[model samples]
Target: LGNTIVFPYSYKSSYKSNLLGSSTSPIQDVNMEEEFELKDGDVVTEVVDGIPTIIFFDQVHKYIERRMAKTIIMKLLGRSIGFNVLLKKITSLWCPRSPIQLMDLENDYYLIRFNSEDDYNKVVFGGPWVIFGQYLTVRLWSKDFSTSQSKVDTQLVWVRLPGLPEGFYSDFLIRAIGQLLGQVVKLDAHTNSARKGRFARLVVLIDLKKPLMSKIKINGRIQRIKYKSLPIICFSVWHVWT
Candidate 1:
């Protein structure tokens, strides 16, 4: 393996096989010494009990994915917060050797995975994890883990262009917003039915070069910007569990 990705929620294995013997999956035992010839860099599988078990012999670390959690759902509730910052905080506490993978189901809700069950326990049961002072609810994931990673998109900050003047085309709107709110990585426009067909009520999705506060200037006037998540919690200490 290039580098071992450690997950606290991983399964422990026995000498007879590299997989957990008590796992719910059906597996059959095999006699590696007599069944077949093994080498340093080959992959083989045998039914143990009723479940299929794979063994990579001396190089199991390189070929097997042992650092991920299946059926281990970690639902989170800090979407109105910065994704990168939140990810950094959680990773710093868990400190997994492999790149941590997370999926943004929608809004601030996310599905996070750890390298081991211990890390999951630490985060879920470690008590009162407050990120940016917003209480984080951690729990076991119940959904399928095979969701394609491509569903992940940029964590966008939605800005309400309340007073956009008439004739504000896409180019001009993007330029105007960029000048006020900082650089825009990606810009998109949407119309709401609640606006009653008024162009001034359009919403713009902005992927900022950096995160910003809740206020910005538009047409030289300070305007409060609404985002997908604007929690009422105040900033507080960031607790770590290492």
Candidate 2:
């Protein structure tokens, strides 16, 4: 009922009486009858710029508030998976503590509502989630989301600097090297402590359209780069797979 304007009986009577006083009322009774015969529960819409726009009152906010913390939107990049298949695969992969609800949205997008906040957080922070060899992009739901124009251009990926010298494990040096691939998001715990000598792991935000860097020259020596959970591409048919 917040921010919703309700006309009481007196107000409606007063308005009708005031209209009767005028010989030529701008708003006629017939027009009023046609427009204001509102039901107890009806979705209200008004014309705005020649387009019908829904009028959401405080009640809408209440509904949104209930689900805001536990709702997320997801889209699979470069591929479309059946709803049943995707649901089954994701349910098994995520294994949420409580049940989850999935709703199909426009443009291969899906809405997920989790019963528990812990499940929501796990899904939100757990990926670079991949399904059917395609990246499943997960994002917190927003009011301004538009499926038609939205595009998945960037993604968080774990990159490995294999055979890197132990001396280069310093925070400053590792971050500097990580820049060669993309924006360095964070260093893996073991990599930060240099406990894992085999390779240094860093989470990087990379552009999907750009060709991934295979190697970088540091001090005139080449260092090989490896990506975890990267999709494999078949050169013959240009099909990507896990």
Candidate 3:
């Protein structure tokens, strides 16, 4: 935990909502798992449709613990039919169209891997500091994804640290931008100054709000791609202050 910042598990949702229906958020127990990289102090929250699915004690709601959220969602789904009934729903996390591919345990499950770095950059805010840019992502995870190991069949957020040096940039940025799309989104994307010799432009997005569109973050540098749109918001922010 020295150079590696300790993002605690407190950020994990304390409750969950059955997003399937009820017109409100549900309550759930944060299913702690070995895969949880979140430490014991990291501030986190789980919410849906504006209502926090779990109680939180963080400075702000930013990254959406993809695995945690997925678990909560799974609980929600399971609640509908009771936890004992896996039925064919276990595969929904893999193929949405034909998630029900099998009933037995062999093809009965799937893995949850969140590595859609390209997808996150395209839709919401974008970032990458290297001049030519070899690796531009910070964190990526998946919910019911396809992996080589036994399919987790649950949400899992993975980290993809930027190619930049430590402590220069990403200080003010959320750990995982894509995970916290909707409910509320904010970021403080920044880059290591070109003169710093860090040779990396840092983009830290400080998320301070709630869900925008599922897991989209909104901040000054957010893309108009959504990258393109950031300028518009910054322009507006500048005008209001002036």
Q: Candidates ranked by lDDT, best first?
A: 2, 1, 3
Clashes of each: 24, 0, 63
1-242 per-residue lDDT for model 2 (tens digits)? 00111111111123444334343432232123222333445457789999989876665655656535567777887888776677778877888766565656677777776666788767865676878777887766767667674565455667899999999988889999999888886788899899999999987876656767778899999999888745553323433331
lDDT of 1 at 237: 27
Give lDDT tens digits, candidate 1, residues 1-242: 01111122232233243233333312221111113335745778889999999866544442222333431333344336554555667777656554334544444455554534565545544444557665454434432333343222122233455545445536556456655554343334343223322432322322222354456665677755554432232224212211
**Model 1 segments beyond 4 Å from truth?**
1-79, 97-99, 144-242
* lDDT agreement with native, every candidate: 0.42, 0.66, 0.27
Best by lDDT: 2
Candidate 1 Cα lDDT to native = 0.42
Cα deviation of 165, candidate 1, in Å: 71
Instruction: Compose the digit string of candidate 3's lDDT tens values, residues 1-242.
Output: 00100011112111122222123211222122223245556655667898887553442233445333331111121112322233223322122221111111122221122223333342233322111212211222333333342322221122222333344344334334433432113333333222343323323332313122212224443322132122112422221110
User: Between prediction 1 and prediction 2, which has the larger lDDT?
Assistant: 2
- Candidate 3 stretches with Cα past 4 Å from truth are 1-115, 127-201, 206-228, 231-242
lDDT of 3 at 224: 22
| Cα-based TM-score, every candidate | 0.29, 0.55, 0.19
Q: Pick the candidate with the highest TM-score.
A: 2
